[model samples]
Target: MRCGIQSFFFLTLGGAETLLLTSMAYDCYVAICRPLHCHVRMGRRLCVLMVTGSWVMGSINSCALSIPYCQFRAINHFFCDVPTMVTLACMDTRVYDYMVFLSTILFFVLPLFGIVCSYSQVLLVVYRMSSAEGRWKTYSTCSAHLTVVTFYYSPFTYTYLQL
Candidate 1:
């Protein structure tokens, strides 16, 4: 039961936070790459829908992941997570590990990819500008968010991939 709760918490919270970061990346992409269309393309309605969808996705994912850990089991690692829990399970966990990897790719890797692509485009756009000041000015907007992404995604990727 405790393991189940842990998986549930990780899935729900992790998914939401990951998706929120993805959304912010999209915001930066749209803002920098397509300023004119940003307002029209990403309105209040879309933002709300994206946020609601993230919560729904997180809950659904949590439910899916929690079911597998229904029975109590020992966790091998310091934390209660799918990877550690899988390692601790008596049953063969090769299949579960693959599933977790796939889910991690979906929940984590894809978002990181989107963030990379977003920043890449932002870079291209800034480079296309004539003045160095313009480039610096554009990059300044995203630097803070990018810093946060670096700190957040590095450990996350290490955690999932290392597991």
Candidate 2:
């Protein structure tokens, strides 16, 4: 039961955070790419929908990853995540590992791609801006967000992708 709860918490939290970051990337895209439409595009309704969708996606991910475990419970990792749980299980876990990898691609790699695309457009716009101050401000805003994203995703990628 504890392992189950841990899996639920870890997967749900990771997915929610990932999707929230993607939503923020979209917010940035709209703000920079469509400044005039920012008010309309990112209004209260849209923000709420984005946040709700993130949580829903997280829940769905956790549900989809609900693989039954065996009697053994010798968890060697700090957290009770999918990989560690699979390792501790008595049965073969190759198929489950593949599923985790596919989910990672869906939840992490795809969002990172979207973020990169958004930032690429933002970069183009900032490059074309006439005011030096505007360019600096945009760069500073994006740099801080990117730094936080790097800190969040790097360890996750390393932990999940490594053999």
Candidate 3:
């Protein structure tokens, strides 16, 4: 159905966006926390791998969620949310729901956890710095990243968990 296809498109786009943000966060983490080894740690090959993984994951998730919706034709929301559309289906959707849950855990929850852990470690090291200047510099570098992380994660959490 058109609605099903549209939903797949948007979810794919959203997933890709999340992946992009996550990759950027990883880059920032390396740059700030491992300045001397940034080049070696984030080489072109690794960057390519990260990006390819993101897209592949996003595509696979989108396809997995979309394939089961061949039975459903209507979409209630303004955007195509695979979960919502799955709920509207007349046929059994237990398997589809389970897959969506798994994908959500994999794509969103796990990445969020990684980002939090990475930032926590970075903060700990920054706070342990002996020099005030070093602390300030580290904090300054991390502040922007933290702000963006908060902005991205807050809404994502609210949407997926709280709300």
Candidate 4:
């Protein structure tokens, strides 16, 4: 019971964080790529709704995933999770594995791809600017976002996708 509950919490947190990162990357892209319309596009109501929707989706996904593992209690690792739960459970996990792969694509791969594309467009726009000081300023702003993104994703990719 405890393992299942804790795993549920972790799943919810992971899903929420993934969505939050995706939203933040989009927000960054808009703020930099469309400075003129950013205010209108990223209004307070929209921001609030994005956050609320992230949490709601995260919660729903967690519920849908964890509800089935209630009876399976033997956690293989130090924590509860879909992988560990699937391994511990005595049933066919092919569907669960597929869901996990699809979620990884939706939540991790897509967001990372969008973040890269958004920043690439931002870079192209910044590159075309003639003002040295303005270009430097814009590049510096993107540096912070890129830094965090690189650090966050590099290890994740290495850990999961290594050959």
Most accurate candidate by TM-score: 2
Q: Give the TM-score of candidate 4.
A: 0.78
Backbone N/Cα/C clashes per model: 0, 0, 0, 0
Instruction: Report the C-alpha lDDT of model 1 over 1-163, residue by residue, as the tens digit.
Output: 5656666776777777877788888898888788888778778887787667566645544433434544666656665676666665656677766777777777788888998898898888888999998888888888998899989888987877874
lDDT, candidates in the order shown: 0.74, 0.76, 0.70, 0.67
State the local distance difference test value for candidate 4: 0.67
Off by over 4 Å in 1: 44-49, 52-78
Give the C-alpha miss distance for residue 17 in model 1, angstroms. Answer: 1.6
TM-score of each: 0.81, 0.84, 0.81, 0.78
Ranked candidates, highest lDDT first: 2, 1, 3, 4
Q: For model 3, give the 10-residue run with minimal summed lDDT.
A: 63-72
Indicate whether candidate 2 or candidate 4 has the larger TM-score.
Answer: 2
User: What's model 2's lDDT at 51?
Assistant: 68
Q: Write the per-residue lDDT of candidate 2 for residues 21-134, one digit (tens) a residue.
A: 877887888888898898787778866775675665456445434566566457777867766766666666778778777777877889899988998999999999999999
Q: List the residue pairs that clash in candidate 2.
A: none
Q: Could you report the Cα RMSD, in angstroms, for every candidate shown?
A: 2.9, 2.5, 2.8, 3.1
TM-score of 1: 0.81
lDDT of 4 by residue, 1-163 (tens): 5664675576557656665666677777788778788778877887677567556545543433444643636555766555555665566778776776666666678878878788888888888888999889887877887787878778667744452
- Candidate 3 clashing pairs? none
